[model samples]
Target: MAETFAPVQPDNRMAAMSIVAATCFIALSTLFAKMLTTDALGPALSPFQVSHGRFVFALLFFVVGVAVIRPRLTRPHWGLHLARTGCGWGGVTLMFAAVAFIPMADATALSFTSPVFTLIFAVVLLGETVGWVRWAAVAVALTGAAVLLRPTPESFQPAALLALGAAVAMGTENIWIKKLTRREGRLQILLVNNLVGVVIASAALLAVGWQSPTSAQWGALAGVGLSMATAQSFYINGMARADASFVAPFIYGTLVFAALYDAVIFGAVPDWVSWLGAAIIVAGALLLAWREGRKRPTRLHPVAGVVK
Candidate 1:
């Protein structure tokens, strides 16, 4: 008798729900960061201070999670982990800097450029072949980004540039993460990511002079931490169950959630032009995701390989 194995089936419904949950949690984290840094709010925090709190609080939550789960701690890919850590930290720092100055919707829209950057990097660095349709989609996405940026003396802000920088760094980090996922468990990756973040953020906080958060601010910080951890876990769970292409489009939900949060919390509703640009960006991203999903393995023809 031959041994049989269970067939693997993808739970797309669960994956979609997980991605939605992750987007909501991420939006909540961003909302907390915004509130904490608003000048009108008592004890308004600096960007660096907010970044430090996010990582520190997130680390504590992860530590508790690791203790409860008892996942494997040892991994052989320290170099990759270090590179990912640096990229993740750079992305986070830049994003927080942007959030300190820009509206939430604009910042979120800018960050959506990461997928476009990732596509370019895949073609250039990984030598992947992309069809002209995908290339055209990339061009459209770039145009959308330019529309949002509107490079004029009055329209162009340094914070927008920082958001783009954050996207690039995050895109690169995600590439490394894809490689790591081939060999490492999700728990291991999360542990290293949070641990590195905590260490680097602590050092930076010391260099810049740490400010003690008020009791209310502490609650906001905790919200940031809790949301970050929850979002990461939900995203990982979703990605594990569904194809990357299927899950990628759902991640755009972050933009919607961000806009809603901005409207509710800051009373800052996006104008018509911003909405139009965001729609274009979302269209381009969905096109790219559709292309990715259509990729199929080429089959060898029986007659082609035979010697006549």
Candidate 2:
């Protein structure tokens, strides 16, 4: 039998640090991306270029990290790696579009829907059982998204939909990563996942034709890559040492950074209603974390078809 880890006591304090590190990096990256898109690089820069720059940096970072850390890059599961790559690229493409249009906080808030999609996919695709409480938590989270989007208006921006697409892609990516980690080392998994992104983004850039990014623009693009690479590395290291359920709530804390970035960088404060919606979203994320924390850690699930 697999050694069942205790739910509350995780092995890696460093992992917690990684999660925190990712939050900070993501927040800063959001601000940089907003600046790059709005001020330095115009919307004409295209999602393809943005994604290409992001993956290129991430791939370089992962490769260098593996060289220094000496993590084995065994190709244990190419198929799973490919799935994660596709999902990651899709999520990035959609999110870049969303961020280009919507406020960062709003985009972040909408992205929370991923966990809900994950939970549902777990039940349907993985055949995992979920109780009423989990279901209730999912509903609360969806309701919060509804409030934020206010779908009643046709004038509602498509950025909201793009955000949802990103969330769905990310949710699928998460499920696959959880499965991949079961048989793969954290660094190795990251290497393959990032390489996939680099390849896909490269193809997109080629098809769209590459842009000559200015020094400042390159920095923003590099920031996207560096921040994303750092965040994933930290998050995986943290998860290795801690219960995912315990660490999941910290993921929501990214919103605090998002709010700060929006306020200080763009002076893009969310309205009262938006704030309320954000609160609900955070609350739902917390509930989901609490729910997962209460459960016993079982053997990690196997990788399958995409969840969302």
Best by TM-score: 2
* Residues 1-308, model 1: lDDT tens digits: 12222212345566667877998899899888888987545678876788778887878888888789886555448888888889988897787788778875477567777866766666665455656766666666656655654444432486789888998998777566655654566666777777888888888888889777888888898888889888988876665544443454566567657767877777978788757766775686567556655655233233332212
Mark the regions of model 1 whose C-alpha exceeds 4 Å error after superposition. Answer: 1-21, 72-76, 94-112, 125-164, 237-252, 281-308
Q: Give one digit per residue, the lDDT tens place, for model 2 in 1-308.
A: 23222221243345445666777777677666666656556444666777778778988998888789885445458898898788877887787688778875577567767766666666565565666656666576566666655544432477689988998897777667766765577878788887887788788888979767777788788988999888887777666654333344455446556766777767978787767766776686567556665666444223331222
Candidate 2 total steric clashes: 1
At residue 219, give the lDDT of candidate 2. 78
TM-score of 1: 0.73
Q: TM-score for every candidate vs. truth?
A: 0.73, 0.74
Per-residue error for 147 in candidate 1, Å, reads: 5.3
Candidate whose lDDT is highest: 1
